[model samples]
Target: MDFRFSPSDDAFRRDARAWLDAHPPAEATPRQWERTLGADGWIGLGWGRTPYGNRTATLTQQVVWAEEYARTPHTPPRLGHIGENLLAPTLLAHGTAAQKDQFLPPIARGEAIWCQGYSEPGAGSDLAAIRTTATRTTATRTTATRTPSARTTSPRTPATYRVTGQKIWTSHAHEADWCFVLARTEAGSHRHHGLSLLLVPMDQPDGSVEVRPIRQLTGTSEFNEVFFDGARAHPDHVVGGEGNGWRVAMDLLAAERGVSTLAQQIGFGEELERVLEEARDTADPLLRDRLVRQWAELRTMRWNALRTLGGGPDPAAPSVAKLLWGGWHQRLGELAMAVRGVAATAGPYDWTESEPYELDAAQRLFLFSRADTIYGGSDEIQRTIIAERVLGLPREARGQ
Candidate 1:
């Protein structure tokens, strides 16, 4: 495949860079960022057929936008755009006309936020074993949010099911307006059957939902534990039909492997650059070789990602990408500490003071990346997927 961008793409990139430089909302808070991006029509540029996104934008154009956007000095945070990037695409593919009309505009306008409710203490990547349930119940008057960004219309229908369960490691659950939840709709069902993807309201007026942020090693809480105690999902909110949820959820994961990845590489490049700058003053010869190797590996990972972008769901592709980046990031974290030498171990506060144990960026990166291999999917799980699916090896027996 040809590796260079075309002349037209170059021109488009220039235009994008100029506009971003002039407008300069990169430092805006998440809410402000969404409003600014939405007002400027930059929120969902390339998604096809939706009034919210510009379908005329080609794949190359999308990549160009992603690259430029990621490189800006202070690009706007994504805010609650799970509605735009992850959930919207899935909904565009499988949602009903009412669902699309109800959900898409608010997301396009950048007025709402969204979160995923997939992981639990019992199920993460092995999601078919999920025990969260949305049982059918009588039509009850319940407060409901249609999308993370918009309020539902006056009551025209009744609630269909009541959700009762717990979800752990839920990113931004505290701030999301809605959560796309995967739950077992049929009782006593096991593994990949009788599940439904329900659009649930995070801010139910009846106090049926609770969200508590999980503090990480970095001393920040971007993730949360969410509890749904008899929270109701309105009948129209059932996405992709009642029993086909596992398929819909899988489709969403496949969407996780797309052009957005190229943008992620840009951020990874920045982190590596910081590490290189710190390593510059180091007299140690060993750190130099590790830095050089990391640069080479990052370039290769970029190429691999480009080669596989837009390919069909190959089953092993997601696993391979996760393994590559997760391990690389964890290594990068280790290298950051090495560059700091002995100073890396010290925190910012005195033990006797009211507060203690603060970290700078490098320390935080080192601490957070420790879980890079664990979250999303573990290395062991990825290897299993590669062995069983990619290589056509015999499946491993349970309880081994």
Candidate 2:
């Protein structure tokens, strides 16, 4: 596919860059920043003209917007990305008209934050092995029925599903207003057969949903453990109908690696530049060679990503992108520490002080990047997908 941008695309890039420059991030919180973007019609660029008043941009323009946003310094990590990037695309593909109408407007307006409820303690990489369940139920109120000469009463109400289970590694669950949950909806069904994607509200008034932040090695708590005990979901909120969550979830995963990845690469490039600046005076040939290799690999990854941007049905594209970036990021972290020498091992803290300490950029990068190969999907799982699906190899044996 041709990678060249049209003049209009260049104009869009300039407009995006100017807007980003004019609106300095300053001290805006993540949610405030999201609204800021939405106010300027910067959010939901990929979505075409909708009744919700979202700006429509071409595919190239979307890429340009992502690149420009990443190039901006001190921009807060987007809290609305899961909703705008992942869930929005999935809804466009597999959600009902009502689902889209209900969810898409809030996302486009940056008024709603969403978390994904997919990974479980036992079903992280093997998503089909999920054990969470959504049992169908109904609420009813008495209605008078005229029979013979007397009035009789009957009860009836709308159908809803009671969700019950735990989801670990749920990113931003504590801050989310909603969660798209994958749970078993069929009785006695195994593996992928019985799953349903239910749009559940996170702010349950009855305390059915609970979120516990999981502190990480970097002393941050972006991921959380979410427990749903009898959480309610309306029947109308089911995406792609019931018992079809496996496909919808896969579609969302595919959406995860699109234009946003180019923005991610821009961030990676910035990190690499920081590492290079730290290593500028180093005389060690080995360290210099490693930095050059990293630079080269990042370029290659960008090209590979661009090559796959046409949205062809390449089964291995998403897995390939994941493996490339995951390992590359981990290595960059190691190199960051290497450039920092022994000083990277320590932080600014007083053990006697009641307050907690903070981690510098290098230390935090080194520590957090350790999970790069593990989260999202592990290296082992990615390789298995490429082997069995892309190369037509025999499937790995599993215990029944």
Candidate 3:
């Protein structure tokens, strides 16, 4: 396959670089976001319903955008995972034409932010057990009914959810303007067949939505526990067909895994590069070798991601990339700390401490890498995917 960009794509690259030259990143912290948003015209550099791009855009183009953005010293938006991974793709794939027109433009323009309402106190990895219920009232409206689900398949009303469950570990709920929720819509054998995805408005003027941030180790309530009592969403908010939420959610998850990899690879690579620059003098030969290995692995990930972005979808590969990225980033962090010697645990230096830039970016990366394996399916989970799908191994025992 021809991996190189065509002449037109080369021209586009020149044009994009020239645009960045004209609109250099802002100095004022607040203005940085505005400038970048104005220049890129997207909250993120990867996947979207491209007014200017589509699924057909060359993977090389996607790689160029990701690398260029990562290399820039400018700050990008701290996008919530829900908006980037789940909500945008879901809306584009299944939403009505009007819904796409209304929602996507704002998402593209960075005017709206979104979060996920999928996991609850009792329904995290085993997500099908969710008890958030939506009962349809009129064609356009429904009410939420939420009680803790002890049983896996506790059924309530028809017509979807009148969502009333409390969702915990919701990232950036307080900062979001919208939420994409998966609620129970049917009653039966607790099978995967009974769920539905719904889009709901949050942060209304009337105080209908209450968002309380849950504190984290980072002193930021980047995650939250959201309680929805009698929260109403229109029936039209349902994505895909009724009772098809489980399938729809899986599709969304695939897209999430797919598109998320490109941005993540770039970010991880950036962190690795930072460690190389900042910690290389103190780094031992072995540690430096590990860092080089990680760099190579991350580059491999970028190429794999670019292939996925350009080629037809591959279900098993993203999980593999996710698994490798988490482990590689974690290793780099540990190695960087070792290299830093006594200064590893030291707080930001007198010169750089005041700056919000990642002080000891390695330390920060190390701490965060622990979650990488956990969040988008664990490393073990990814292994299972590779074994069963890619390696053609026998499946493990799950009570499915």
Candidate 4:
């Protein structure tokens, strides 16, 4: 990969830089930034003119935009990052034209927030074990708190699948407008064979969907538990066809690790740089070595991530990236806290066990990064992927 910007791309970069200078993202609210970005056609750079202000942009432009945007301060928190990063790409590659037309524009405009409905109490690391069911039926009801009654036909209403299951550690579920859910659509079907990926509306009139915020150690509620009780998805909403959700889910995961990760790695680079700047005056030899080692590891991760991009997607690439960054971030968090000495362990006197804990930057990093290894995919799961897919190892037996 050349990694050089074309002259036209440079001009584009200049324009973007000038816009950022004028906007100074920190001063505006997230929604306000979204409107400005969407109006200017910067939100979905590679996707084109429908959402953002541009038409059929090149991949180079996307890269340039990501690079420049990260360089600028007050870049609005990625408000609809899930929709733009994972879902849009998946829809482009596998969704029907109608699905694309319906979903993509909203994502581009930061209007549609999305959540993933994959992990369940029984199926966190082993996603193939998800027990959520979507039974086709004519009857519509909310609340799947009980086992769905067997199909009884009614001629009056259009048929829809009743989604009944629970998804835990669902990021942004509480605020999402929609969710892409993987459920068993085939009765008595097992493992990867009987699955379907359903795009479900979170704001159903039946009140079948429930989102409860999961308080984190950081005292934030970004993660949630989502319950689906007789929530409905039109049969037409299945992506990549019904009974092929396993494949669709895998493709979405691959998309999860695509070029967008370049921007993430860049963000990681900034975090690592901050660590270096903060610890510069400290003379502790052990701390100094850890910082240098972290820098080297970050460089290696950046290289690996970049290489995967040029070579195209692999089943294990995202796992490798996740494993790399997840562990790296956790360790960096520890180092950050270590540098803060005793203050890392202390909080404000008023902040007791009953009150919501307030955290400083280093304290927050140390606490929150603990989940880095567990949330995306556990470190064990990523290793299993690398062992089986990349190395051609025999598959591990899943207990029946």
Candidate 5:
């Protein structure tokens, strides 16, 4: 497959680069920056012309924009990416027309931020094991017994879901205006059955929803633990229908590893460049060889990602991509520490002081990348998927 960008794609790249250059991240706060991008129609480039007011771009053009954005220096990490990249694509694929109409506009406008509510304390990579529950309910109640005196009734109201459960490692949950929760909607359901992907409002007036940040090795708290106590979602907000959330969640995971991977590769390239600079004077031949290998493998990962573009949903594609990037990133992190040697062990603060301290760039990279193979579906789970689903291997035994 040809990976080269066309002349028109080059033109699109120039336009995107020009816009990013003119609007440096220092000029605006992250939220304001998001709004600015949305107003200019830069948020949902991959989605075609819809009433959502998103700028329509071809697949190659989307790649161009992503690469350009990542290549730009000092661009703040996007505050709207969960909405734009993950949820938006999922909605386009499986959401009802009403869902698209209601959700896409705010995402395109960058007015609403979103976080995912997929992981649980016991069900991180094994999403089918999630125990969160969203029970269907109505404002009124009705009960009847054989005895005439036992009959009771009340006025009916629109049905809603009373969500109750906890979600762990919820990225950006504290800042998100909304969350798409994967919860079992049917009573006594197990594994993948009877699940529903719920579009939930985060700002519950009754204090039914809570977010607590989990401090990380990098001294950052982007990952969070979220508790839901009778939080509500409209019955209409159940995406991909009430009992088909497993499929919808799988589709969203596919989107997670799609075009977004290319942009991610660009960021990896920047990190590799930093590592390369740090290793320039290294005397160990083995270390130098490993550095060269990292550069080559990253290039290969990019080409592989480009090759899979526009290929209709192949179950193996996402698993393969995840395996490649996850391990590569973790290795890069390790290499970064190796290059820094003993200096990597210490932070730039007085250890005896009681105040909090920060990890330097290399330390942060090493510590955070340790989770690369764990989060977003662990390496073991990815390989199992390939074996059972793609390679037609016998299923692994599971405990009841």
Candidate 6:
């Protein structure tokens, strides 16, 4: 891959920067800025721009936008993972004219908010075992159950699931306008074959659904447990064809891992920069070596992510990039915590008198970094995929 930006990409970068300067987000709060970004149609520039939306933009343009957006401070908005990552790509690919018309404009303009309904109580990492059932009903698609029932064994060829199961760790559920849910729509047949994806609206007049926020260790209610009791969706609400949703979801997940444009890496790189600044004051020689190693890892991760976003479609690169980034983030967090010395156990950022941001950052990093390997997909899972699919290794048994 040439990897150099063609002239057009440079021009597009200029235009984007100029637009950011002229129309910076005026909202005082993060939530308001998220709304402003959605309203301004700036969240997913990939969906809004014609060539990019059509998959015609040069990789350079994509990379340029990613880096530029991440670098701009206090101007561009911080949309939740829903708008920036998951829903936008789904809408771009499989959404119908009416669905796209209904969804994208609000998402682009930040009008209609969204949350994910992927993980169930028992079916988190093993998502295919989800028991939320959406039976085909005359007036609308009717759900049978929504309460947090005890875990049921994965059914074989489930028919009429009645959806009495609960979905945990659902992000931003209370504030969302709609949820992209994965539920069983077919009877019989195990594995990923019988599942279907649906866009279920959240805020209804009769209060058919219940959303209870799941608080984090940091005391922030960033996630929730959503209960759907006899909730119904219109038949037309199904995304993609029957039995085809798993394929659609896989594609979305790949995009989620792959589309780490330079902008996102830049933002991530900021965290490393902070670590380096604080590490310079540390006197330990062993700690300095670890910090140096962490710095190298971050740089390597950024380059790999940039290549994936700008170097066109390189199937093997994304998992590699994710693994690199995830592992290094953990290491950087470790280094930051070490630099905090004995004050690492403090509850808040201001609790430590020495190396305050460094200490607070370490606390945040240590808490958050644990999920880096598991979130997009586990590091073990990604490595296996790379070995089997990319490296052409012999297939390993699923249960083994």
CA RMSD of each candidate after superposition:
6.3, 2.6, 8.3, 6.0, 3.9, 8.5
Residue ranges of candidate 6 with Cα displaced over 4 Å: 2-7, 24-26, 29-31, 38-41, 48-58, 75-77, 139-164, 347-359, 392-400
lDDT of 6 by residue, 277-323 (tens): 87777788998888778778767776666656655566677678778
Q: TM-scores across all candidates? A: 0.91, 0.94, 0.79, 0.89, 0.94, 0.81
What lDDT would each prediction earn against the true structure? 0.84, 0.91, 0.67, 0.82, 0.91, 0.69
Ranking by lDDT: 5, 2, 1, 4, 6, 3
Q: State in Å the error of residue 303, model 6.
A: 1.8
In model 2, the worst 10-residue window by lDDT is: 45-54
lDDT of 1 by residue, 1-400 (tens): 6657889989889988988888787467788778777776776765675666533466777789889989998776576557778888898889999998898877877887899999898887677778899998766465667887888855645547899999999987988999999999998888888999999988888999999999998889989999999898987899999999999998898777677878888988999999999888777789988999999989988888877764544677788888998899999999999988898999678868886676888898899999999898788988998999789999987631
User: How much is 356 displaced in model 2, in angstroms?
Assistant: 5.8
Question: How does candidate 3 score on lDDT?
Answer: 0.67
How accurate locally is residue 234 in candidate 6, as Cα lDDT from 0 to 100? 59
For candidate 2, write residues 317-397 as lDDT tens digits.
999999999999999999999988998887788989987778888888889999999999999999999999899999998
Per-residue lDDT over 24-118 for candidate 5, one digit per residue giving the tens place of the 0 to 100 score: 88878888999999999999997888888889999999999889988898888899999999999899999999999999999999899999999
Which residue pairs collide in model 5, if any? none
Off by over 4 Å in 4: 1-4, 26-29, 48-54, 139-155, 351-357
Model 3 spans > 4 angstroms off? 24-57, 78-85, 138-161, 188-191, 204-208, 348-360, 388-400
Candidate 4 per-residue C-alpha lDDT over 124-157 given as tens digits, one digit per residue, 9 for 90 to 100: 9889999999999865544334347764544456
